[model samples]
Target chain A: MILARGLRKSFGDFEAVKGIDVDVRRGESFGFLGPNGAGKSSTMRMVAAVSPISGGELHILGMDPADDGPSIRARIGVCPQEDTLDTELTVRDNLYVYGRYFGLPRKEVRARVDELLEFVQLTEKADAMVEDLSGGMKRRLTIARSLINRPDVLLLDEPTTGLDPQARHVVWDRLFRLKQQGVTIVLTTHYMDEAEQLCDRLVVMDKGLIVAEGSPLTLIREHSTREVAELRFGVAPDGDSHEALAEKIADLGHRVEVLPDRLLVYSDDGEEVIARVHERGLEPVAVLVRRSTLEDVFLRLTGRTLVD
Target chain B: MALDQRADDQRAGSTAPTSTIAGAARLFDYWAIAYRRTWKGSAISSFVTPLLYVLAMGVLLGGFIKGDPTRLEGATSYLAFVAPGMVAAQAMTTVFGEVTYPVMGMIKWHKAYFGMTATPLSVPAVVLAHLGFVLFRVGTTCAVFLLVMAPFGVFASVTGVVAAFFVQLLIGLAFATPIYAFSAGLKDESAFSLVFRLGMMPLFLFSGAFFPITNLDPWMAALARATPLWHGVDLTRMLTLDRLDWSMVAVHVAYLAVLALAGWFWAVRRLSRRMIS
Candidate 1:
C-alpha cells in the first residue's frame, strides 16, 4: 500500500533521511527499528504527507503524496510521537471534531465517536476533559482519534515509549486486535521486543540507512548462531588470556564473540560447546546457555551502545 | 426478530455520509471551543478597558471641563462624545489583539495549525475560521459597549448605535486582515510586539479616538485622515451627534471599504502562498 524510492529529506547542510527505498504490503505490520536520530521519525513524517520530500518517488494507496496529499491523508491514520489532542475539548468532542475535519456528517460523527470510544475503552470518560486523562489514557484517546475516519493504513510512532508495563501490554493488546482485523500497521520503535512482538517484517535503521531487513527470527538466525553460551572469566581476563580463550573457543564453535567482561560462544549446541570447554580445563566464573534473539542480532549489527 | 433488526440497522449505517458545508461548520465549532475556553480573559479585557476609559476620561475629566462650551460639542456631554470613540477603539484593539496572538500560537508555540492541517481541512478554511471568530468577538464587544454607553446618555439616536456597530466591524476587518498577513510571515513573537508598540499605539493616539484630528498639525491631521481608524471614529462621531452628511459618510465608507479589501487581499495571498507552498 506504500512505496518509496530514493526518498531523501535534508535540513540545510545536514541530511536527516538519506536516499532509501521501502515497500510495505497490505494487511501486514511493518516496523522501523532504530535508536533516536536514526531517521525513523523523518521517514514517518514523509509517509504521513506532513513533510515535503526533498527528492523521491513516493506513493500511498497508489496516489502520489506530492499531488494527492489530502486524498491520501484522508485514507490514513497517524499517531505522532507527541500527542496533539485539543486539550480544551472533551474526550468525545475530540473525536467528533476530528471527524468533522474530514467532512463527516454530524450524525455519523456522533455514531463513530461512540463506537471508537467503546473500542478504546474510554466510553465512561467520553465527556471528561482531555486534560484530566493519564498518559496511557491520552495515548489511547489519540489512537481512537486517528481512527475516526476509519483509515486504510495506521501509522504509529513509538506507541508505547513512556507507558508502564501494564499500560504497554494494554496498548499491545489493542494493536494486536487491530492487526487481527486486517488493518495495515506501520510503527517505529527503539524497543526490540516490541518490534519482535508486533512486526511481521522490519528494517533495522542506522545513521539514516537501512542496515538489515527481515522477519525477527530470520534476522536472528541469519546474523547470529542458533545457541549462545555466555562465559564470564574471573579477575577480568587479561589480553593474553582473552586471546587464548578466543583461540580455545574458535575450535569449539562456529564463531566466538568476546566482550570486555564476558565471552560468547556461538554454536549449534550450547551443551556440546560447554562440554568441550570443560574438557579443555578452562575454569570459568559463570556460564549461561540461551537461544539467540533479535537483541543479539541487533547488537551484532549495530553495536551495543546507544547512538544519538 | 431483534437480531435481524439490529443487523439491518448496521447495514443501513455502514455507508459514510458527507457534506460540503462541513468545513465551515467545523470552523465554527473550533471557534466555539476557543471562546468557551478563554471567556474570562476575553471578557475582562474587551469590556473593562472601554468602561474604564469612559469613567476616567468622560466623567472624571469632564468635571474639570465643566460648562466649557468648546469641550462639550453642541448639546452633547463630554461622556457622549468620548464614549463612542472608546467603543470603536476597543473593538479594533480587541479584535486585532485576539486574532494575532492566538493565530501565531497556533502556528508556532502550540503547533495547532499543524494538527489541523493533518486533517482534510484546507489552509484557507482555517484562516477563514479564525476570522469568523474574530468577527463574532468584535460584534459582541461592540454590542456590550453600546449598551453601556446608552445608559450613560452616550447615544443621540438609535442610528448612532447601528453606525457604531458597522464602524467597529469595518475597523476590525481593516486591522485584522493585515495582522493576519503579518502573523503568517512572523518568525518570532517579537515582531508582533514591535507592530503593536510602533504601529498600533501610534494609530490609536493619532486616529481621533480621544480628541479631534483638527486640533493636530495639518500634516499629522492628514496622516490620521488616511487611516481607517480615523475614518471609523469620524463617521461614528458624526452619526452619534446627528450631524449626518451624506457626502462625508460616503467618503468614510469608501475609505474603510478600500482598506479592508486591500488587507483581505494581502492576507489571502500570503496565507495561501505560505501554506500551500
Candidate 2:
C-alpha cells in the first residue's frame, strides 16, 4: 500500500529523515519504533503527503504523493501526534465539518457521525463541546474523525501517547479490529510493548536512520541474547569493585554490560550465569532474570537513556 | 455494496470541498449562526449607539449649527443631513471591524484556516466565503440602521433609503476586501489595534460624515475626497437629500466600484498564496 525509496527530509542544515527506504504491505500493521528525535513523525508526514519531501520517491496505493497529494490523502486517514480538534464546535460537529471537507453529502456525513460516535464510544458526548472532553476521549474522537471517510490506509503517529493504561488497551483493541478488517496501518511509537503488540513488522530508528528492520522476535533474537540477568551491586566494597564483577562474569556470559548502578549478564542460560556469579563470592543487592525482549533490542541499538 | 458507495464518494471530483459557491454558502450559514449567537449583544449595541448618536449629535448639536430648520441645502433639518452618513459609517465600521479581526484570528491565532485547508477546501474559497459573510453583515446592519433612521425624518423617500443602503454595502465591500487582505498578512494582533486607532479613526472623522466637505479646510476637503468612505457618505447624503446629480452619481459609483475591484484583486492573490501555499 505504501513504498518509499531513499526518502530524505531536511530542514535547512539539519536532516530529520535521511536516506531511508521503507515498504508497507496491504492489510498489515507496520511500525516505526524509535526514541525521540528519530524521524518517525517526519517519515509519517511524508507518507501522509502533508509535508513536501526533500528527496525521495513515494507511492501510496500506486499514486505519487507529490503529484496526487489530495487524492492520496483522501484514501488515507491520519491521526497526527497533536490533537488538532476544532474546539469551536461540538464534538459531533467537528466530525461533520471534517466530513464536509471531503465533500460528503450532508445526510451521509450525519449518518457517519452517529456511527463513528458509537464506534469511539462518544455517543453521549456528541453534543458536548470538544474542549470539555478529556485527553482519552479527545484521542478517541480524533481516531473516529480519521475514519470519517472509511480510509483504506490509516496513519497513526503515537496513537496512545498520553492515555491511561486502560485507554491505551482500548485503543489497541480498536486498532487490532481495524487490522482484521483489512485496513493497512502505519504507526510510530516510542513504547516497545506497543510496537510488539500491534506491529507485525517494524524498524528501529535512531538519529534519522533505521538501525535494524525485522519482526519483534526476529529483532530480539538477532540483536539481543536469549536471556538477561540484572545484578545490582552496592557501592564498591574495595578498589574497582564493578570492574572486579565484570571480570568474574566475563567468561560466564556472552557479554557483560556494566551500568552505573547495575551490571547485566547477557547469555543463553541466565540461571547458570547467576550460579557462576554466586560462586565468585560476590554478594549483589538484587538479581533479576527474564527472557529478552524488544526493549533490550532497542536499548542495545540506541543505548539506555531518554532523549528529550 | 456499502464499500462500493464509499469508493464512489472518494472518486467524486477534484474540486475542493469548499468551492467558491459552497464556501460562500457555508460562510453565509456561519454568519447566520454567529448572528443568532451574538444577536442580543448586536441588538443592544445597534439600537443604543444610533439612538445616542442621533440624540447627542442631531438634536443637541443641531441647535448650534446655524441653518434654516426646514431647508439646509434642500433638507428638513441637520438631522437629515447627518443621519445617512452615520448609517454609512456604521456599515463601514461593521465590515472593517468584523472582517479584519476574524480573518486575522483564522490565520494567526485560531489556526482555523489550517484546519479548513486539511479538508478539500481551497484558500480562495475561504477568502470568498469570508467576504460573502462580511457583505451579509453589512447588509443586515445597514437595514437596521435605515429602519432606525425613519422616525427621525432621515429618509426623504423610499428610493433614497434604498440607495443609502446600497451605498453603505458598497463602502463596506470597498473597505473590507483590502483590509481583509492586509489582516491576512498580519503576523500579530497588535497591528489591528493600531489600524483602528490610527487608520479607521481618521477616516471616520474626516470623511464628510458629520458635516459638508465645503465647510472644512481646503486641505481636509482634499483629504476627504481622496478617501473611499467620503465618496460613500457623499453619495448617501446626496441620495437622502433628494439632490441627485448625474455627474455626482457617476463619480460616486465609479469610485466605489474601482476601490472594490482593486481590493478584491489584491485579496484574491494574497489569500490564495497565504491559504493555499
Candidate 3:
C-alpha cells in the first residue's frame, strides 16, 4: 500500500529524516520502532501526505503524493500523535463530520458512523460531547474517525502512547481485528512490546537513519541470543563500575552487556550459564532468567534507550 | 445550505447518494457546525452589540444634532446620516472579530485547520471557506442592523438596505482576508491583540464611518480614502440616502474588490506555506 525510496525530510538546515527506503505491504502490520527523535513521526507524516518530502521518491497506493496529495489522502486514514477531535461536537458527529471531508455521501457517512462507534465501543457516548470523554475514549474516537473513509491504509503515530495498560490492550485488540479484516496498518511506536505484538515487520531507527529491519522474531534471533540471564553486583549504581564482574563472567556466556543496575548474560541455555556463574563462586545479589525479546534486540541494535 | 436537503434526500434512499461539492461550500460546513455549538455566546458580538452602537450614535445623539443644520451633512436628519455609518462600521468590526483571534487560534491553539487539511481539503480551500464563513457572519450582523435602522426611516428605498447587505459582505472580506494572511504565519497571539487595538479600532473610528472624512485634514482624508472600510461606509451612506454617484460607486466597489483580491492572494500563499509543511 505504501512505498518510499531515499526519503528525506529537512526543516531548514536540520534533516529530520535522513535518506532511507521503506516498503509497507498490503494487509500487513508494519511498524517504525524507535525512540523520540528517531524520525519516526517525520516518516509517518510524509507517508500520510500531510507533510511534503524535502527529497524522496514516494508513492502511496501507487500514486505520488507531490502530484496527487488530495486524491492520495482520500484513500488513507491518519491518526496523528495528538488527538484532533472536534471538542465542540458530539463523539458521533466527529466521525460524521470528518467523513464528510472525504466527500462521502451523507447516507454512507451515517452508516459508517454507526458501525465505527459500535466497533470502538463508543455507542453509549454517541451523543456526548467529545471534550467530556476520557483519554482512552478520545484515542478510540480518533482511531474510529480515521477509519471513516474505509481507507486502504491506516497510519497511526504512537496510537497507544499515553494510555494506561488496559487501554493500550483494548487498542491493540481492535488493531489486531482490523489487520485480520485486511487493512494495511503502518504505525510508529517506542514500546518494544507494542512492536512485538502488532508489527509483522519493523525498522529500528536511531538518529535520522534506520539501523535494522526484520520481523520481530527474526530480529531477535539475528541480533540477540535465545535466552538471557540478568546479574546485579555490589558496586556503584553506574553499570560501568561492574567491569570487574563483566570480566569474570565474560567467558560464561556467548555475550555480556552491563547496564546501570543489571548485567545481561546472553546464551542459548540460561540455566547452564547460571550454573557456570555459581561454579565461579561469584554470588551476585540477584539473578533472573528470560527469553530474548525485541527489547534486547533494539538495545543491541541502536545502543540508545527505548524510552527517554 | 442545500447540502442539508441533499443529505435528507440521501437518507430517504434516493437513487444514488452522490456528494457534489461546490466551491468551498463543503469547507463552510466546518465553521457552520462550530457556529451551531457556539452561536449563543456570539450574540453579544454579532447582534446585541452592533445594535447598541446604532442606538447610541443614531438615536441618542440625533436629538442634539437635529437642532443643528451643519452636522446633517446635506441630509434631512442626523439619524439618516449616521445609521448607515453604524452599519458599515459594524461590518468591519464583525469581520475583524471573525478573522483575527479565531484564525490564529485554529492554527496555534485548537489545531482545527490541521485537522481539515489532513483530509482531501487543500490549504487554499481552507482559506476560502473561512473567508466565506466570515462573509456569512457579516450578512447576519448587517441584516440585524438593517432592521434596527428601519424604525428610524433611514432607508431611501428597500433596495438601499439590500445593497447594505452585499456591501457589508464585500467590506468584511476585504478586511478579514488580509488579517487572515497575517495570522497564518503567527506563532503567538501577541500580534492578534495588537491588530485589534492598534490596527482595526483606529480604522473603525476614523474611516469616515462615524463622521465625514471631509472634516479631517486633506492628508488624513487621503489616508482614510485608502482604507477598505472608508469606501464601505461611503457606499452604504450614499445608498441609504437615495443619492447614487455612479463614479464614486464604481471607485468604491473597485477599491474594496482589489483589496479583497490582493488579501486573498496573500492569505493563500502564507497559509499554504504554514500548513503544507
lDDT leader: 3
Clashing pairs in 1: none
Best by DockQ: 3
- Which model scores highest in TM-score? 3
| Candidate 3 lDDT over residue span B221-249, tens digit each | 99998888889998998888878898999
**Tens-digit lDDT string for candidate 2 (A1-308):** 89899989998889999989899987789999998899999998888876778897888878887777667766778897877776666788878777766666678778889999998899999989888988889899989988887777889999999899999998998888888877789999998889999999999998898999999989999999999999998886464578777987799888887777788888999988888889988778899998988878877887763233
Share of reference contacts kept by candidate 2: 0.14
Each candidate's fnat: 0.27, 0.14, 0.41
Of the two candidates 1 and 2, the one with more favorable DockQ, higher being better, is 1
Q: What stretches of model 2 exceed 4 Å from their correct place?
A: A230-265, A269-293, A304-307, B1-19, B23-36, B67-76, B104-110, B213-225, B242-277
Summarize candidate 1's per-residue lDDT along A150-235 as a digit string, tens digits: 77789999999899988888889889999998788999998888998999999988878888999988998899999999888887
DockQ of each: 0.29, 0.28, 0.35
Q: What is the C-alpha lDDT of each candidate?
A: 0.79, 0.80, 0.84
- Candidate 1: stretches off by over 4 Å: A228-290, A304-308, B1-24, B40-49, B66-75, B108-110, B181-202, B217-228, B242-277
Give the Å error, residue A305, model 2.
4.3
Model 1 Cα displacement at A48 (Å)?
Answer: 1.4
Model 2, TM vs. native: 0.84
lDDT of 3 by residue, A158-265 (tens): 999999999999999999999898678999999999999999999998888998999999999999999999987766465336777898899988888878777899
